[model samples]
Target: MTGSSHPVIDVRDVSKSVNGPEGRLDILSDVAMQVNGGESFAIVGASGSGKTTLLGLLAGLDTPTRGSIQLDGHALEQLDEEARADLRRRLVGFVFQSFHLLPALTAEQNVMLPLELEGNRAAREKARTALEAVGLGPRRSYYPAQLSGGEQQRVAIARAFVHSPRVLFADEPTGNLDRRTGRHVCDLLFALNRDHGTTLVLVTHDLPLAERCARCVQLQEGRLEPLA
Candidate 1:
């Protein structure tokens, strides 16, 4: 599988369950999916349908309770936390719905973090370029609080792309913006995908956004169904 160069992500019979107050709760079950390199994919479903959980597993942020997940040829379940973190740093980038920016860091600093962690000497310059790419260059010095909701989200997008990761995971990226703003953000996201040929796995409720991807999978009652 490693020698072959087809799939970037492969999940086989994956399931996730958690211990709840009532008992065990199954969040996802028997989910199998694959996304090829340089492909754009989407997971669309209603709230509590395990879309985010699937994204986390794909990104190696969380381990599935059952089955195997191979991300970029590495087995996620076999990696320790430190190894997973290292892999994420090296190969994965994430954009959260909440825009999880460090309050103490300005937009530039936030975008620079990943590059700095990777020991890149041009962190500041690369960060600046990413911000400029997202049309937030003028607000590079501003903290998250100083920016509008849309501006803050733009910063997050910049941060996610600054490292030029092999794969990008976005969970409800446009959830916080108005319709027009969301459309703009979506366009920017796809533009980045086009420019970099990055593999994209997005969990979104936006039908148009989902339709833009090469493939779309839907979650219903913790099970995956093909969206035709």
Candidate 2:
């Protein structure tokens, strides 16, 4: 799927607002972007700059107030909640700064969760391979509490890509780690993105991290701004 002609994500005239105590609060205003298949695109902004809000919309976790989003060629606003969730299950993967692994599950079990949800019979085997890819094969039996921050994030990354999603959304993936460990995670992410030909949509406040992407767009006080 290298150099794919079709866009995996397309956003047009999108605006998102929420009712606040003061009045209406706009989180995004008429944002438009097209992320081509297999492209690495970054949504970079400062804290409270609506980066996460836009990521959620792109991933179909939430809907925009005034426009359409096409994810993997499906109109997200046209899908109901369950249909949108199903779409996410089929096409989207995510990594968060908090390392959202289940506390009670072992690394292997955590990695297997997505496959198991889809009733995959080879969940265990696939999870083992994913963990091995992340250099955590030997720690498959360890719980999240037993692993260091870096190891936990590694597990999260493995779990994210285990089902082989079309788009991988990462929100400040390195925010919780030290500089050295963060670099390792970044390398792993890009390697997987390359090998899998997966569309990477990264949201981060760190300019250096955002710079790694092929293209980048910044959000400023809820408006889209081109980054030089």
Candidate 3:
């Protein structure tokens, strides 16, 4: 399938608020950002700064209370949950800090889940290749509990990249790993980005990690400011 020339993610004047015990609390306010195809962008902020919220909004995992978000040229605000989920299945992949793998599934099984969900006939072969790419070929049979934190995270990364998604959203992908392991994971992520031309939108608090991205946007009270 030919890739779209339009920006993979476009957010304009987006704001989100929630009801607090006392009153309404705005998590994000008037935030605008764009991530072009194959670009690596970072959202950096302190805890409670709404970085994750912005990432979720950009990935169409959550809706913005106000403003607009266009993902792969489709207006997200107009789509219902099912439609948004369909779009996500087609264009997006995500890696989370927690390495959310199914405990009952082996590493290969976890990677195979997405391909199987898409009804691909080569799911096992594809899953094997993906695990091998992450240097976990021998551990393909290991379940999440059988692997170390770094290994589990690598499996998660493989799962996200298995389908060669056009847009990848990572939320503090290395947060659970040690410094050395985190560096290795980051290297793998960038290598995949280079080889597949996947657009990467990462939310992180790690300064050096954020610096590795092509562009960095900092969020404060849900507003974006380009990092100098």
> RMSD, each candidate, Å?
2.7, 0.9, 2.0
Task: Give the TM-score comparing model 1 with the true structure, all chains together.
Answer: 0.95
lDDT of 2 by residue, 1-228 (tens): 463879999999999999999999999999999999898999988899999999999988899999999998899999999999999999999999999999999999999999999999999999999999999999999999999999999999999999999999999999999999999999999999888899999999889989999899899999898996
Residue lDDT tens for model 3, 1-228: 223356888899999999999999999999887788988889999999999888888878899999999998999999999999999988988999999999999999999999999899999999999999999999999989999999999999999988888898999999999999999999988888878889888899998999998889898777799886
Q: TM-score winner among the candidates?
A: 2
lDDT of prediction 3: 0.91
| Candidate 2 whole-model C-alpha lDDT, 0 to 1 | 0.94
Query: lDDT (CA) for every model shown?
Result: 0.91, 0.94, 0.91
Query: If both were scored by lDDT, which would come out higher, candidate 1 or candidate 2?
Result: 2
Instruction: Report clash pairs, candidate 2.
Output: none
Instruction: Give per-residue CA lDDT, model 1, range 95-212, as digits (tens).
Output: 9889999999999999999898889999999999999999999999999999988898889999998988889999999998999998898898888887888888899988888999
Model 1 steric clash pairs: none
List residue ranges in candidate 3 displaced over 4 A.
1-5
